[model samples]
Target: MTLLIRFLRLILGTGVFVLVFGGVELTQPETSTRWAVLGGTLGVLLLLHVWSSPRRGTADDPHPARMSDGKPQSGRAKRQGARPSELAAALAACRSAFASVALFSGVLNVLMLAGSLYMLEVYDRVLPSRSVPTLIGLSVLVAILYAGQGVLDFIRGRILVRIGGALDEALGARVYSSVLKLPLKVGRNGDSMQPVRDLDSVRAFLSGTGPTALFDLPWLPLYLAIIFMFHVLLGLTALVGAIVLVLLTVYAERLTRKPVTSGTQAGIVRNGLTTTGNRNAEVIAALGMGGRMAKRWEEANRDYLAEQRSVSDIAGGFGAVSKVLRMLLQSAMLGVGAWLVIEQQATAGIIITASILSGRALAPVDLVIANWKGFLTARQGWQRLTKVLTVVPADAEPMAMPAPSRHIFMQGVSIAAPGTQRLLVQDASFALEAGHAVGIIGQSGSGKSTLVRALVGAWLPAAGRVRLDGADLDQWSPEDRGRFVGYLPQDVELFAGTVAENIARFEPDADPALVIAAAKTAGAHDLIVGFRDGYETQIGELGEAVSAGQRQRIALARALYRDPFLVVLDEPNSNLDAEGEQALFQAIVSVRQRGGIVALVAHRPSALGTVDFILAMNQGRVQAFGLKDEVLAKLFPRPQPAVAAMPRLRLATEEPAPPLGAAAAGE
Candidate 1:
């Protein structure tokens, strides 16, 4: 399994990084003939990578599985809306670029031989023979090789930049949506930003010099082999040095990984706390808890700093060891080569070339040790983002569907808070026909909000079905359904846009007629037109500069703007005064006039007065459902029924629950 994954990674762009492995063959005194063979092998690997496709190693995958005979086998069909996983496929676009870069890296490694070869020729042939013509020829060829290497290096860096950008462009939206959908409890450290932040880390590592150093790593072996060709003793000396460096690299990772990981976790917590503090800055200031908050932040930051210090200590130790070993290894190789010369087993030229090769062999190892922290971060980031990448919907294109009518249905629907095991709502059922407004009254935690979320298809039901007419709610394309469904949450959230845009729900090309009608229906038209820029006046994210009542009125206008088939308003008039209450009642009547179904989660009588039906909830179940008057009378008696004949309905006497109404007495 490990080998398969490694091979897959190579095919996806790690190929360029592995090109350095064949570079040892370049330092030989031979001509361009030997270079061709090693280059040809990498070329073949590139070709194989280009032609390959990833396959799932399981039988139950929705994508077609492969048979033992190497032919395709049919599996269960995939969901109609979901597509096969394309995380790898999207990344594969960079493979060809990496292949080209690999070839360039290999050439550049070969060009490095120009320096050693120039010295070898001058020492062996130029000085003794006094050949000016040969000297000039070698100098020109060496210059050309160096120039080519420089040009290739520049091109390779530019290609890496483009690869990083392409990866972001290919997956940015998908990853962002995935992160948004993730519940807060799903985060590793309760920081919901991990998945998206992980992608950024991955991109940074790919585009940074870390990958370049890693690619050079494979060339160490080639360099070692060349030194061995010079003399057995020098080769063995360099080989031993390489082994020590590799072991040191492994040891450094082992020593520092835990501390670095702890530091990262601490950092995530610090950042999350900082964000929370900023978000509630007003509350903190009003409550005068600044000192306490600062102390808490300092404590979290101190833990992070301590962990980072431990990692730094380990890194410093490894770096010092790696530097000393590498320098000694070079000096030792020279001594070994010199002994061979004294014994008449090698030439003086062999001593210098062998020393240079040995030094180059250890350079990459030391470089990796230097950048080990960043490399470890990139690895962890990849692991953190892998699952989300696989699960993110690569294809969100909607299917063609006719518009939905106002008839709605819910049959035994159940719902739970995301990432929690207990259900917040269960066995709840209701139906609404056109030209009717339904009201849901419940205590604060009575699942009214959860039911509304399920109705809008934002939360999928765990047990039952929510449908529009005969079609399952999940079957409808979100884009198509969005046109017919307008939902206003209890908080009355708004984006940064003009008043008109907010009312039009930030649609770029909003219909003027619909926008005007909705604003008028919600009693916001006059208020907006009176603003400095009228409908064009800017609104803050939290509707800053606008009163809470104004924001609620604006949200109500947004919900009513599209003349949707279904409208859901959660506590629409919660922050409104008597006039705003009248406006909300009028808006509910407007939805009824348009032959639409409206579901209102409300606590105030003004918000519930216009509704034709009432559903009262307790805990997670529907305790009463009937005409508004019938449910109200059942919950609250005409005058307090006689002791023996009292109503048996469960009624919430807490804040926000509607008290007994006069309509209940006559009914």
Candidate 2:
């Protein structure tokens, strides 16, 4: 498509050039200067086209990076070892589209001369000669040029929109992946969604008029040159206006940069508050804290608006000043042209022509000033996206390894919370073989959930290794690891989908039989069947439609789906009642019976009934690990009767002093 657009532009440019060249030759037979000017302009445009053209990748390149949609990397990108950021690579992929837009802009800017030339000919040629046919001819030619200009402009706009779309296609999934993984790397913060919003801002700027002004900026020199051909004074006037506008643009940047940054920070805070408030709506309402939350949000929003208003005022002020200055400059060119004509140094036609040319020259500057905020936003977004992609580099596709069924081992594993150095589990060395079910028991914050998370690769060990069948967890790709490792987090959160779909992990081609089988194994089949749509029942967002126990049971079904080799359940029965607890117990026994390893993190002793082994943790350290009865006895030894007799003897001795009636009389 890019090539086709380029070819069509080339053909149109050639045809227009031939027509204009012939017309100029016929109209001014003695002047070779016009020919030189036309040739130079074409040469400059061709040079820009070549400079903007897309580069192709080659096998011999030292550093290679994937382009949008997995296209070959551009050989021109010579970054060594480190791959180019995803945003950069994606933009490089759209270089052809950009080149095409540039070419179209060149053609359209050249055609912008139609109005000036038509005015010049009407004043200097047709009116003086009273030639009606000549006037008609000039109008026809200008009309054709204007039509081509409009077509090229439309094509340029379309290409820019597609470039934005292509960029989104290239980086959307990667950005979303970063959004998910960034918390694990940098910890969850207010700006978790910033990357995605940044991407949207970039795409929006590309698809808007901001880039059109940018593309037309380079042609300012061309217009100024034409005005110089008319008269240096007129050209100098336009140049001064352009310089002032450029200065205004720079000033706007300096003035708004801090405010834009502040506004973005404020927006992040506001959005975070909104998200938190929405997530805990019930608590907020029940506690009558809605007004307070709203107040906080309002304060954040007010800050954001203040910053935004500051930026807008600066941009609007500069835009208005530039627009007025540009108009005044055009009028100044006319005044200068009229004086030159009066002095018999130039023709009457030069008056109108120079004014139009000068205005055309300054139009881009005016546009850029007006859209300065958008330009800054796009630039900032680009910088942010580059940083994020750098921070969380793309995952390398590791070589496939066979599924593990032997043992899960943690050799001196130390686990820390994401984005923090505080170790939650330290030197926790342990191993569980196939068919072994270990219940991870601990007090609150003893790192039972943290340990199980490491076992399932949700959190990586800061020190030592987590190995599955002798292979480190990092050796397996996430997709492959997920197939063998099943994890139920302490909080059971389900996505919005049908019960069967959730059980099947939303696989596009999930089998109904397998889904039902997994549900039955998790002991959620009967409960699910009781729903209005049975397995087809739609679970609302976060499984809000179901009760807490139901959500937990459904999550258990999801974790137990496909009979994963390593199943890690973190407080899996937290919300389960007696019946749900029984089902969970049976599910653990079922996993063990199937030769699968189970690591269940639970506070309730009843939930550990089916486990063969117990792993006790305390203060981020493994307290004990052995048979369930042995570990339990060690952790909670039975009280001796001799020790219990002391308190009873003291109580009996004190109570023997008085009966109820004697106590009342004494009182």
Candidate 3:
């Protein structure tokens, strides 16, 4: 659409030239010749206008009112609108590319004006004999200049494209850098699924149209100014047309603001859906709830579709209105031009030139409108991205590194999510020597995981402090803190790569021997060897192809690879079967034996039976803390009695209460 509009602009410029000469001839004393020129020029102008007008039936305009069925029409697709730093970079590139073009273009416009004056002198018989050689030379020079312009324009376009590519890289880099430092909760924002959809939209604003707007910004204004110089009144009229068109573009942009916001919110919903689906996929499959899950997915998807329709409708309506306004302006200019000629305030030549220049002046504004919405949208995306960029990570600091110490201690630690009264963990205090194993156990939502997370400095306690050696955890630099602490969440995730690669995710140049040693210590080496490719075998998405036990082991291996002084494991043995659980328990003991402080959450008594100490929790508060056996005895003195079996009547009364499986399945 942008290219077509530009092409029309050039053709319109040519039409202006022809009309100027033709109208001048029409003012001559000879009626026969004057009528012929006027007729030919008017016919050509009419044909060109019709040819240039956008068609209603094309794919570009598949549905005048909407993009698809049940979707609302886009207000104006053209109005579809970048990052601030990115926009700045694009603007710089554009200015550089257009400098030479603008300089030469000005020269060419002057030459064109001179040539028109010379022709007028000849028509009025002021010049007795115009030299043909001089005219021919000027023609050749102008042709060559224009040809050079064509080449320059192509080069400029290519340069702009290259600049756009660079800008995209910069934008992506900025996002990645910010993401790496973001708090896990913030980085995990938009739900995991949202990144799949919203990231692409972000890229579009970055790579596709963001830089293009910056490129056209220079040319559009220059062209408009040149048209304005041809005739003051016509210029003003064209300027007004441009302004009105710009206003329409602004109105359309305003209309889309709400929809764009809705779209972003919808993206959040999709993220939630994705997280929900991922967290529940196994349950969905095992329970045969595929149809229900599909229905839920469908509902969320439909909501997204509806939001998209709303956005498109706003854009399409804007486009329709803009087109109508442009046409109206075009007609008005020509009609007023004719009137001026009839009143003798302007010559026929002047009238034709003014009309042509009017189109030229208004054309860039038209093109601007087409890209305005895209530019605006890009800006909004930038704003969203900028919000991410501005969020200071919890661990960002002034670069002073805390002194390394083997002592890990928490003093009156109390943690909670922001703006919430629900405590995640409260007034938890403990001290661990350089080498020790501590087991934390609680039912779900008892804050066992939160305690470990806080210990590792993943969660900032609202009150109290985590101290390493003598220095506070917040006093440590990010690198120092990361190097000292390692963590494993309940559910482990593995990227698509070799076992060795997954273990050394952050250490690109990690030794294969080191990776093997870590895997062995984490008890993942045997499972890795069982694969056909051994350690080189690729893991599928989230390591879904691997058993939960394997995933947990791999996570342990990753933590082992870090070789931190403190390892915080949230349910390291939760996914493991009996044998796998034994292996993980051994790994925990081995880490402590090797002088690493190990803190693991476990509910199963057997899994944590060997730990040095037990921290029993209930409802975010510590219930008991002492030697493992002592704490266990205090928490549960004896097992609760089993439910008494109902008496069974002889002769198999009630059909033996059905099989347990049958009864459960039936329920």
lDDT of each: 0.74, 0.81, 0.62
Q: lDDT by residue for model 2 over 1-667, one digit each (tens)?
A: 4565466456556645654465554344422244335545654665565565543211112122454655535445544633456677677756656766777787788878768877877888778878786677667656756766776677777777777877787789999999988988878889578899999999999888989999999989988888887778888888898898888888888999999888888989989998889889989999999999999999999999999999899999988888888788878887888899889888988898888888788788888888789888888889989988988888889999999989988899998998899999999988888999998888898988888888888787899999999999999998889998888998888999898889889988898888888888888999999998999999988888999999999999989888899999998888988888888888888898889999988888788888889999999999999999999999899998664444434654464667789889999
Candidate 3 lDDT by residue in tens digits, 54-161: 343121232223234433223233244222343343333333233423332333333333333333333333233454543453354335335534543453344444
CA error at residue 580 for candidate 2, angstroms:
1.1
- Name every residue pair that clashes in candidate 2: none
TM-scores, all candidates, are 0.82, 0.90, 0.72
lDDT of 3: 0.62
The candidate, 1 or 3, that scores higher on lDDT is 1
Point out where model 2 deviates above 4 Å.
1-72, 77-82, 643-667
Candidate No. with top TM-score: 2
TM value for model 2:
0.90
RMSD to the hidden true structure, all candidates: 12.2, 5.6, 14.6
Return the TM-score for candidate 1, rounded to 2 decimals: 0.82
